[model samples]
Target: MSRGFVKESDQEELPIIPPRAPLPAGVINYVTPTGLAALTAELNALEAEKADFPTDHEGEHRRAVAVIDGKLALLRPRISSARVVDPAAQPQEEVRFGARVTLRFGSSGREQTFQIVGVDEANVKEKKIAFTAPIAKAISGLWAGETADFRMGGKAEKLEVVKIRY
Candidate 1:
């Protein structure tokens, strides 16, 4: 059968799938207990949605299934490689993964709080930052009332750890 003989309507365009969140190479995929639970819930929801997809329109159904499968493919590895870290189990005296830290800036007398979490669970709106973030890395292992020099934009600013809680 020649391509010129085929109907144009028979050709199906592949669905575009979005990429997952970036995780740097060589870094372990660590997830808090809550983060792992959320991922599991998301996977289950996608599975249910795929299972309930309507089959009345064959092309639409196939495209929908393909998109869901793509998402599942990206998600499965994250879930499988996840190393769950319990926030409560961490040391309470110092900054570490899952620590909610309060920091004061030098000269400004201003304070801010952030929770150091896994890459999949980092949400700026919620004041949660990934453990790999520059600020998080700078402040890691510091005890309450300790200070660290944070460099940004070629300028160094002091960050004082006011409090640490798991």
Candidate 2:
């Protein structure tokens, strides 16, 4: 059992598993129905990949399976904790989770539209923002024609709600 008797080739390197998007402590894992479905799909894909690992090279196969397992380890809890919220069931009169809101910047008079979604589903390229984001927090529960002051980095900007849709 001495280190002098151990071989370097016998040691297995742990695969680096990337962390999922951050959800602040004690914050409920709220997810849209679509977001939940996407998480489930990702879990299924990882399971399939783990099962289909090639066995031609034993070490390679083991490393590949370990990586997939690590990913699944992180993903499973996220799926399990998901609380799906249906966009259609949300109140349409005010901005809430899953609401597609259009806002006009008071200073520039430029309009931008984005949907408030869960942390896991937030994608700026798709015009979706996390509910915990500063702008989303500032505008939540506001109705069309209402204004909210969004402050970031010690600077504040006025945002006017131009439209709200579920």
Candidate 3:
């Protein structure tokens, strides 16, 4: 029972499972129809990967399976909780979920376009932002030519809605 009696082989490194995109508590898991389809495709791909896991190298296969399992565990709940919202169903004149918005910064007079999407669907590189994002929240429900203030890193930035599209 002494610590000195324990064997080094008994100790093993634990697997690290990466966290998924944040979805704050009490917030609905809203997804665009395209977003839902993407998630479903990812799940299917993961399943196929797991099924084809190589068994020749026991340790490699085990580690691979563990990683796949971790991803599936996180993804399953999000998929189940998803509420699909069609972009075409949203108002074409006002910014809302699944709306592609064009904004102009008041200070710099620079224009940028971004689409408001679900958490899992958000990718800055793709010009898609989550509905929960500060910029998205500030402009949501706003119409063209409307302005809203957003605070970023202790500075307030004014954003003007230049255009909205489904």
Candidate 4:
């Protein structure tokens, strides 16, 4: 009953798992239902096939598990907090995460709309662009009606920001 003593059965130390690093801030993470489903399916397939890995392939199997664990870890976290650059909680200024920016080309006069999202949610074909990409970099902090130049395929291409939305 003394505070400094414990029964031998209760003296075992509990495992202390190290915490993962905090996720990046100020980035929009938009996950499509299809993408999440695919990720889940892939993990499932890995689980189902994991039993077949031979003892000789233990290294490869562990590597595979690590990869799957990393993917699942990222996927498991719900995008509950969208830390945009909006101190007012109503962003109406420079490009920030979760912003739908409209770009207008100064040279060709072409315009396009893109939603800036995190790396996991970026699909150029779907127009959900990654904030760290080259094209995204060109327009990340630009304001509406502003033009920015990009070099692609050895040619200088022009882009302009026409609009943005949350």
Cα-based lDDT for every prediction = 0.93, 0.92, 0.93, 0.62
Q: For residues 11-111, could you state the per-residue lDDT of candidate 1 as single tens digits?
A: 98888999876889989998999999989998999999999999998888989999999999999999999999998999899899999999998968799
The residue-by-residue lDDT of candidate 4 on 1-166, one tens digit each, is: 8956876536644433334323356544444444345445755765666556555765556666566555555545633432323322435777766677887766677778887665655777978876667787787677777777898778898887778776
Q: What C-alpha lDDT, on a 0 to 100 scale, does residue 130 get in candidate 2? A: 96
| Candidate 1 TM-score to native | 0.90
Q: Lowest lDDT 10-mer window, candidate 3?
A: 6-15
lDDT head-to-head 2 vs 4, winner: 2
- Local error of candidate 3 at residue 120 (angstroms): 0.4
**lDDT per residue (tens digit) for residues 1-166 in model 2:** 8998998658877889898889999989999999999999999999998888789998898888888988999899999999999989998999999999999988789999999999989999999999989899999999999999987457788999999999
Look at candidate 2 and tell me the lDDT of residue 70: 88
**Cα TM-score of candidate 3:** 0.93
C-alpha TM-scores of all predictions: 0.90, 0.92, 0.93, 0.51
Report RMSD for candidate 3.
Answer: 2.0
Per-residue CA lDDT of model 3 for 50-98, tens digit only, reads: 9998899876787788899999999999999999999899888999999
| Better by TM-score, candidate 4 or 3 | 3
Candidates in descending lDDT order = 3, 1, 2, 4
Model 2, residue 62: distance off in Å is 1.9
**Which ten residues in a row are the worst by lDDT in model 2?**
149-158
